[model samples]
Target: MISAPLTRRAIFAQAWPIMLGQTTVPLVGLVDTAVIGRTGDATALAGVALGTVVINMIFWTFGFLRMGMTGMTAQAEGAGDAREVEAMLLRGVVAGVGLGVVLFALQIVLIPLALETMAGGGALDDAARGYVSARFLGAPASLAIFAINGWLFGRGRTRAALALQIVMNLVNIALNLLFVWHFHMGARGVGLGTACAEWISLAVGLAIAGRGVDWGRILSPALFGGGALRRLFAVNADIMIRTIALLSLFLWFTNAGARLGATALAANYVLMQFVSVSAFVLDGFAFTAESRVGQAIGAGSRSAMVRAIRLTGEFSLLAGIGFALLFFVLGPALIAFFASNPAVRAQAGAMLPFAAIIPAIGVPAWLLDGIFIGATRGRALRNAAILATALYIATDLLFRPFGESGIWWAFMASYLYRAVSLGAYLPGLLRTIEVAEPANGP
Candidate 1:
């Protein structure tokens, strides 16, 4: 195995590429919004937003493939157990595939329900429903891709993971242009583009795994036996609850804005893209922390954990500052890109300063989440998130008399609370340490 210092650097190196790969997906969405804006149809924009919300809700549910797998595999790696590492990957894939099938079956029921519930009555509603229905058809592929990504990241193959994501985005973008513009397929075209890209990505991911994955023992039923499946489900349940809370906040935000009116919602939506971009970038550092810190904790190396935490925290802070500055400088141009309507652009522009400040304020919470998760303190992580979210809801209720600005302030406060709560737990965590054996036939 590589030395501690080198392994840490390797983690970051892998993360940077993965970060770029991850960022490209959002960039593609931004481009899609931009292109659709030129068509001068607010319904089209609303369609994309609505469809995205539904898909994201579903996708986030399976985020366990990434979070659960990373923690389990990193620990295995740290324990110096190649067989266990292989088992984790195989179990994750099987579980993800099973979940994907379930999701596909549920989509039939879900699409109509979502349209009625989330999409307001109008042409926009019709467009959103159409888009969602088409996209739902690719549930299996999308979930499969999510599983593949989680396994890859867990194995510390960040570059390969990044490459797969980039390819997916590139394919999606090309298809978006071809179907939406060339064929005049409109919202349905965009959905089709996403579906096609997902399948392609799943195929590529499987091929890549075949090349590098140790296959001799992977096919054994022991890998997916009762004990393994139970552990997988248990971890997944924890993550799913956490993700549901997280996604519910955004959904609530969207729904709340919708109640205020489309213009407000649209403006908020535009601003949210900025938040998404910033969070994804910050997540690169977080993912690095998850892998490195989990490995450190598993290896029973207190020193490695301390160092990993320090490096990740410092780097996240630096990265957050850069994102803050980027938002400050490019605020206008970015807002204008998503919003062509004068009112939407103006309102979003006014909100730019608040949005720009979020990364810096939220970085601590984000980084802490990674640290805690790596340490396998998921219960703490869940509690911290729940507490912060409750704080946010309470603050929002009290501040509702103000305006949108008040809501943004509440959002900022939530991040602050999360950071503080998680930070408070760190001292106790550092006092306890457990290291795994080395990987060479441990």
Candidate 2:
């Protein structure tokens, strides 16, 4: 069994890398908004915002690559089965590539659908289309990078995952400046920069995997046969359902903001970036929980699993508190950084408190996600998420009389519900662990 002190240190060591990596996407978004805001074009900002909603929907749908792979690989690592570990990595890559291809094809038809659905026949429509089309070009590489990241994290190499993310975001940011500012490519430039960065990061991630892993075993055709593919698909499907439910809430919120007005939509968009920052940081702890819990489960150590849950949960709580305070102290400055229009900044500032409230209410659910995933209890997670999502939609609809503040309040309530409902299920989950354990075994 892993020692408690060693496990605690190792968990953080792994987590900080993921935390740093996760921080980059929002940073890039914040940068993009800041640069575009300087162009004095509200439409450009709106376009990026709308386009991101679409991209996030598409990309995040396949989050199973990271979630499923982490759990499965960690379990294999804990079980001391190198072959199974390699198989999990191989399966993730194949599935990621196939899914990417499907998403890319759909984008051809979907882009117009999204543009029309979001808003049709105007500058907003034009900008959104341009951004979506350009970003779609990188679908394959983007998906590949997800698989690579999952594989690395599964291997307990959070540092590698972190490095790849840093490289990808840094490159994307630099290219964004060159294309958007120097080349004057606007939304398309930003999209192209993101796509290019994904490809470059995938290349680097592949190199790292090759150096660190036993690819010969992983790539065997026997392991890539129908049974392996079917299992991976099953896991991914459950995760897809869970992710769809999760993302749909955000999508609906954005759509609702759009219905309000451009300024409200933009304000919501900017504030959501702050929420993303918290979510990403919290995800570090989630990743730690997944790896450690999966490892414990794989090794058939109930005590270790319990310890991991406690330690990771504590860490996540602390992180959430830190972010909440950070938002309270520096929120206005952060808002100013993203919005050049004094008016936009003022609007976003008004909403910053709502954003700050997310981590406090949402961190528990986030951490539980990793724990349940490590336990391979995807069905439970999918069900709980769907329930929470249903409540979110219901609450939002009920709060319609109160305007945006009401909507934000409902959003906060949704996170709280998710955390509580998921937490309530933990006791039963622990009982299952006890039942699964051999009477006298570790």
Candidate 3:
């Protein structure tokens, strides 16, 4: 095992790049929002908003492709298995290409569904259609890029991953200006620009990740064995189910918030901004745990894994505390910024305590998620999510007397359940590692 100091440095080295990458992710969306909003034609802005939402939903669902590949690639790297690494990348590309083809084929149905979801008025329908059509052309590139980035991240090349994203965003921004402003192509232009850049980014990612890969070896029938294919499909399927469950909770929260009076709903919306910000920042540390733990598992180094888990816990605790402090001190101001009416502002401020506690509460679950993902314990993760989700629905129903405060309480319980459930599962995981080590029977 490496010394604590070295492990800490390694964790930071891995974590910081991911933080920067996560930071840039929202910037592209903000730029899209800004550029599209400035067009003066409200219909065009509305169209882009609806169109992007649809795009986001579609892409986010397949995020398992990236996450599922990360653990595999990291393990391959730790095992020093070059052929496995190549196959990991190639497998993702194949999955992504296949999925993208399906997405392209379904656009005829998806585009209209997107419009209906946004409650498309006739005025904005055409504009939304234009944007959706243009973006569909790039679905393949986008999904494929997810796989490539995941491989880069798993291989501990987060800086390279960051560079690819930064370049993609820069290209996206530059083209947004050129096509939307200069050419006045409107919604279609924004979609086209993103598509073009993703295609470019894929080329860049492939060039970076694909270097020295033995495509000849990868093309061999031996490498594309049945076992690898099954593992890949199984891991991804588990993650996809978990993702769906997780997303469903958020949607339920939102839908329930809407059912509450408009003022309370608005307050909850702003309050959620705190959760979103904390999540992005905290994900950096989670990512570090993922890479280090995967490497440790692959190398059969329990000491290294212990060091990683400890360091990650320390970092997560500090971040959770820091988030708690911010939400306590600044929550009112942040809430006030989004809450227009005095009633909404006051109610939101009242809920600051709920919001304030979530970061600290959520630390364990978030940190553990990284460990689970790294270890590829998808069944455990999936089980935890299922239970947590059920607890959330039950809590919400049980606490209806408290109104909006009740909803927030339900969310808190759900987070706590996730942490507790996962923490309970950790011992079994650790025992497995212990049993596997020093016996020399394998």
Best by TM-score: 2
lDDT of 1 by residue, 1-442 (tens): 2124634476578569767886997787777777666676767777777777877877777887878788777878877888888777667767777787888788878777766667366877777777777787777778767767776766677888888988899999999899888998888888889888888888888887657667896778787776888987786676677777777666666666666666666777777788878888888888888877778777787767777788777778988999999999998998877778887788788878888999888899888877876666767777777777777788888988877887788877878988997798998888887543455522
Worst 10 residues of 3 by lDDT: 433-442
Estimate, for each residue in 373-437, the C-alpha lDDT of model 3 and write its tens digit. 88888888888888888889999989989888898999988888889887888888776664234
lDDT of 1: 0.77
Ranking by lDDT: 2, 1, 3
CA displacement after TM-score superposition, residue 392 of candidate 2 (Å): 0.8
In model 1, state the lDDT of residue 156. 73
TM-score each candidate.
0.93, 0.95, 0.80
Candidate number of the best lDDT? 2
Off by over 4 Å in 3: 1-6, 29-57, 110-137, 172-197, 225-227, 260-274, 327-357, 399-405, 434-442
Give the alpha-carbon lDDT of every model. Answer: 0.77, 0.81, 0.77
Q: Model 2: which residue pairs collide?
A: none
Higher-lDDT candidate among 1 and 2? 2
